[model samples]
Target: MKTSRLSTALLIAYGIAILGFLYLPLVSVGLASISKARYLSFPIRKYAFGWYEDALTSDTVRDLLVISLKVAGVVTVASMVIGFFGALAFARYNWRFRKTYQKLILLPIFFPQTVLGLALLMWFNALGVVPSWKTAIIAHLVWIAPIATLVVSIRAFSFDAALEEAARDMGANQWQTLREVTIPLLMPGVTSAGLFAFLLSWGNFPLSLFSTGADSTLPEWLFAKMVSGYSPLVPTVGMLTVATSAVLVFGGLILAWAIRRLRPES
Candidate 1:
């Protein structure tokens, strides 16, 4: 009883500490965003929607949103294709270096983003190429694909082999079995993986910052906004970003719930 009570207290204390650490700065920035003062001043003078209006009207922010969306979309598509096949191979095949292969594939997740970004930046420079959205998309795909692969492979392991074998034993070909049986079962995992990849690509700062040109992702644009000056509209952008992420994550939850509830219970 004593240990359990102590553990509960520690957990509650940790949660409170983490919440304060995460949200206090955001609260400060949010307050500054609404301030009527020319500069970011704490204990704000007056509140207005001027900053929000400015952010909405800014072409830079608009373009960056488009670029980030495009990059994320491309990364999702690429990760889906790559991860699907990688998962299938891992799930189906018995081959040499299987353990090594799994570790190698997951290596990207262990890599520090700063180091990965710097390495890619140097490689681009060595290749005598200017950093662009194309490069950013490619860099993002490297990291995103591994995560997608891991998600799908784990889910694939849970897949009922009999269904696939029965499909194959019948008239169904390899492709047909995969399409009809394997894919439907794996849909949830794919959705989860795609959502993860999209979020990763969308929010990636170091990689996007180094690889982007005029067409940069949202995080890169946010960095520029921070360095140039703290415009009152900045928090508006932050709020919108937070809202967008919330919607996506919530939508994904709804989807997962729908899938589960609608699925036939064994």
Candidate 2:
């Protein structure tokens, strides 16, 4: 009992310490954004919403946000489509060099984003392609697709092959079996994979920095401000991003749960 109690105490302490280490900067930024002082200070003297107003109204921020959304949407769709096909190939097919193809697909997930960004940028420049939202979307797809593929493949492994086999035996064509039987069963996995892709693309920085255009994506815009100097406005943007992400991801999880609950039990 004493050993268990000690372990519990240590775990609690570690968790609290970790949270503090991670969130202290965010807390400071939140405080600074509302502080009346020109510079950040401990024990904020006064508070105001002026920084949030400035952040919301800034033309630069607005444009960056639109770019971020466009890139994220494109990345999510492309990643999901490529991932679905890859998952089907991996989960449902067998062939020589299968392991080699699997490794190639997953290689980007383990690669350093900085190296990936530089390599992609150089490749695009060599090809005479301009850095734009399209470039950002395509670059992010390379990294995010692997994770999406893995998610769907894991789901596929748990899947009942009986359904597809039954459809085939019932004279369903290959396309019909895939479109009507396989995909419906994989909806949960696909939705989760798309969400993951969206979040990654929305927050990715190094790749965005290299691939973004004159408009700039949200992360690149934020990075520019941070590189130039720290300001209260920065935290306001951070808070907004955090809040938006939380709402979206949480809402999605809830919706998925509700759908499962509403399904007819066999």
Candidate 3:
């Protein structure tokens, strides 16, 4: 009994340590956001919220937010759609060159983002395509869609083929079986993939760095500001971005809960 208690205590300590390791930096940034001094330092002498207000009211910040949102939103939707099909092909279908196709689809995910971004910039230039927020979406999709596919494929592999067969035997056509049986079963994975895609795209700096030529996302702007000149608003904006991601994560959880609740009733 004493051994079990000790084990449980150790596990709790380990869990707390892990959480602190993950979030301590963000906590420090949060503290800095409220620091009133122009230069940030630990054990802050003064505290104020004016930096957050300045960030919230800044036109540049607003533009960056809008660009980031647009890129993430588009990446989320596209990743879901592509992931759905890719997962089906990856795990459900057995066809010629399936292994090769899988490797090709996931190749971009393995490439260094900086190199990938640079290569993409050259490709865009060679094609006479202008780099912009639109290009950023394409770049993000190249990296994120494969990750989304991998997420959905985990769920897909466990799916019972018998259910699809049974639906077909029930006189349901391909589309109907896909809609009524396959999609509903796979929705959980798809939703999780979307959340991952959005968060990854929103926080991405390397891909957006080269791809968003004239335009800038929040992460890109933050990088530029951090390098060019120090601003008190840096931590403030960082906190805001962190807050937005947390809200989305919580919102996704609530949505998933609602779906689960509604499923049995329906």
Candidate 4:
């Protein structure tokens, strides 16, 4: 009994240590954001919101934030729409070469971000299109859309095909059944997928680094600032990104849970 108790305590301590190792950087950045000093350091002498205030007051920061929002918004909408349609086709139907195509879906998820970014940069350049925010959106769409498809497809598979057949047997047309029955049932999954898309796009760094040629994104801007010098605003802006991602991811989880409650899988 004593040996078992000691082993359990050791496991708990190990888990906490691992968690702390992963989150310590974020905690440090949060502390730095509220530090009285300009540079990032531990055991900050005083706490203040001056860095956050300064970041908010900067016109450059504001513009970059706007660009990031716009890009993320566009990417979110586009990815969700594409993902939904792709899920419908892939999840609901099977045909020749479907297996081959399914394998292709996993490629983006497994591909190295830096390599993908560079490849996209080369593709755009070859077409004589300069790297711009639009290209970044396009690049992000490739990855996030697939993720959305995977998320929505899980729900799609859970959806009973019998309902649509029943609707047809009752003389309902395809479009009418889709509009009335399909969409309503799928709304929660679609919404949660969209939130994931937004979060992924908003926090993207490597692909944005390559595709956002002249236009600046928050990640790129933050990188530039960090390269120039160490300042509290760096951590402040990072904390903002962390907070936004946390809110969105958490909201998505809640939405997914509510969906399961409303439509429990049989």
Candidate 5:
């Protein structure tokens, strides 16, 4: 009993240490953002919202943030549409080379993102497409769609075909039955997938670096700023991005929970 208790205590301590290691930098940045300092340093004395005010007011930062939001929005929608169909097909059908098809769809996730980005750049150039905001959207979609499909597939594969059959038996056409039955059941996974796609798009730097052209997302903008010089506003911007991401992630969790709660027990 003593040995077990000691082992559990050690495990708890290890977990706390890992959490602190991961989050300490982010926590420090958050504190620095609120500090009334023109330069970041230890021992934050006075706290204010001035840095946040500057972040919001800066035209370049504002434009980059807008770009991030727009790109993320497009990626989220596109991922959902692609994921929905891919999940449906993968879950509801069986065919020759099914496993091969699954591997093909999920290839991007396993590939190194930098290589994927570089390959895409070449592919786009070969196709006579200019790298721009549109190209960034395409690049992000390539990386994130598979993730969305995987997330949605988790719920879809668990779905009983009986429910779909009942709908069909009641004189429902394929489209109507799918719209009324399949979609409702898969909404939780769909919502989570959208959130994943959005967050990944918003934070993606390596992929965006190759395809963003002159239209940079916020993470790209942040990287440029950090590399160029020292500015307290850098930490502030980082803090804002971290906080926004945290909120959206948690909100997505709550939404997923609510969706499950509202869904009828099967």
Candidate 6:
């Protein structure tokens, strides 16, 4: 009993340590955001919210938010659709070149994002395509779609094929079986995949760095500001971005909970 209690105490301590490690930087950024001084210093002497207000009213900040939202929203939708079919193919259907196809689809995930972004940039140049938010979508898709597929594939692998077969046996056609049986079963995974895709795309920097030539997303704008000079608005905007992501994530969780509650018990 003593050993078990000691182990539990250690585990709790470890978990707290992990959470602190992960969120301490965010806490620092939050502090910097509220600092009233032109230069940031720890154990802040004065605090103010004016920088956040400045960020809110800045035209550049608004443009960055819009572009980031557009990119993330489109990527989320496309990732969900592509991931649904891809996960089915990956974990359900077995066909010729299945291994090869899986490897090819996932290859991009293994590549360094910086190198991948540069290669994508060169490819666009070769094709005489201009780099823009539209191209950034393609770049993000290359990296994010595979991750979405992997996410959904976890749920797909656990799916009971017998349920699908049972639907077919009950006089359902291919489309009907998919609609009534497969899709409903897979919806949870698809939703989770979309959440991952949106978050990843929203925070993506490397790929967006290369692909969004003239148009800048929030991260890109933040990077430019950081490199050029320190702006108090940087941390303010950072906190705002973090807040937006947190809201979306919490909203998704609440939505999922509501869905589970509303769903009829089988």
Candidate 4: regions farther than 4 A off? 1-4, 253-266
Report lDDT (CA) for all predictions.
0.83, 0.85, 0.95, 0.86, 0.89, 0.95
lDDT for each residue of candidate 5 in 1-266, tens digit (9 for 90 to 100): 35788899999999999999999988998888888887778899889888889989999788888888889999999999899888987776778877888989988998899999999999999999989888999999999999999999998999998999999999999999989998888887888899999999989999999998889888887788778875778888888888789999999888778767876763
**Clashes per candidate (backbone, < 3 Å):** 0, 0, 0, 0, 0, 0
- How good is model 1 by TM-score? 0.87
Candidate with better lDDT, 2 vs 3: 3
Error of 2 at 62 (Å): 0.7
Q: Superposing all C-alpha atoms, what RMSD in Å does each candidate have to the true structure?
A: 2.7, 2.2, 1.5, 3.1, 2.3, 1.7
Colliding residue pairs in candidate 4: none
Instruction: Look at candidate 4 and tell me the lDDT of residue 156.
Output: 84
lDDT of 3 by residue, 108-185 (tens): 988999999999999999999999999999999999999999999999999999999999999999999999999999
lDDT of 4 at 171: 93
For residues 51-119, write the lDDT of model 6, one tens digit per residue. 988999999899999999999999999999999999999999989988998899889999999999999
lDDT (Cα, tens digit) per residue for candidate 1, span 1-266: 35788899999999999999999997887787778887877778789978788878889779877888899889988888888888877775668878788888989889988788889889989999888999998789878899999888988899888998999999899889989898888888888888888888877898787777557777766777789976666677877676667788889889899879988872
Which portions of model 6 miss their true places by more than 4 Å? Answer: 1-11
Pick the winner on TM-score between candidates 1 and 6: 6
How many pairs of residues in model 2 come into backbone collision?
0
- TM-score for all predictions? 0.87, 0.91, 0.95, 0.89, 0.91, 0.95
TM-score of 5: 0.91
Instruction: In angstroms, give how far residue 156 of model 3 lies from its true place.
Output: 0.7
- Backbone clashes, candidate 5: 0
**Deviation in angstroms for 198 in model 3?**
0.2
